[model samples]
Target: MISSIIRTMITEFNNDVDKLSNDLTAQSRNHVITPREANR
Candidate 1:
């Protein structure tokens, strides 16, 4: 049971990271972040 719970948590964390990466990629593709802001 503990192992299953840990696996589930890891899967959720991975999914969250993937989603955040996708969001950042989309924002970058849209040119939403300025170069100066990025440098900061």
Candidate 2:
């Protein structure tokens, strides 16, 4: 039972990390694009 609970927690943690990284990448892309557009 304890092992199952730990496994679930790990899965949830990994999912959260994936979502956070995705959001960061999207924000970084927007930042990169916005500066280039402003320069033009």
Candidate 3:
């Protein structure tokens, strides 16, 4: 049971990272949302 919970958590984490990566890629391609601006 514990292993299953951990696996589910990892899957969700990976999904979140994937979404963030796609968003960053889109922003970079658009050349409007820079890292510096996002840091602010």
Candidate 4:
């Protein structure tokens, strides 16, 4: 039960990261957003 809970949390975290990556890519398409800006 606990392991399943952790797995679900990790999956959600990865999804969030993927979305952020997409957003970063779109923003950087204009050559404006920097690594520092993305970290923010």
**Can you give the lDDT of residue 2 in candidate 2?**
100
lDDT of 2 by residue, 13-38 (tens): 99998897666667667785454444
Between 3 and 4, whose lDDT is larger? 4
Q: Per model, how many backbone clashes are there?
A: 0, 0, 0, 0
- Can you write out model 3's per-residue Cα lDDT over 1-40, one digit (the tens) per residue? 9999999999999999889877877886788788665444
1-40 in candidate 1: lDDT tens per residue?
9999999999999999889777776776779975445444
The whole-model C-alpha lDDT of candidate 2 against the native structure comes to 0.75
Per-model TM against the reference? 0.79, 0.76, 0.78, 0.75
- Residue pairs in candidate 3 whose N, alpha carbon or C atoms collide under 3 angstroms: none
Query: What is the per-residue lDDT of model 4 for residues 1-40, given as tens digits with 9 covering 90 to 100?
Result: 9999999999999999999888997787777787677767
Candidate 2 versus truth, CA RMSD in Å, comes to 7.4
Best by TM-score: 1
Q: Candidate 2: minimum summed lDDT over ten consecutive residues — where?
A: 31-40
Error of 4 at 36 (Å): 9.0
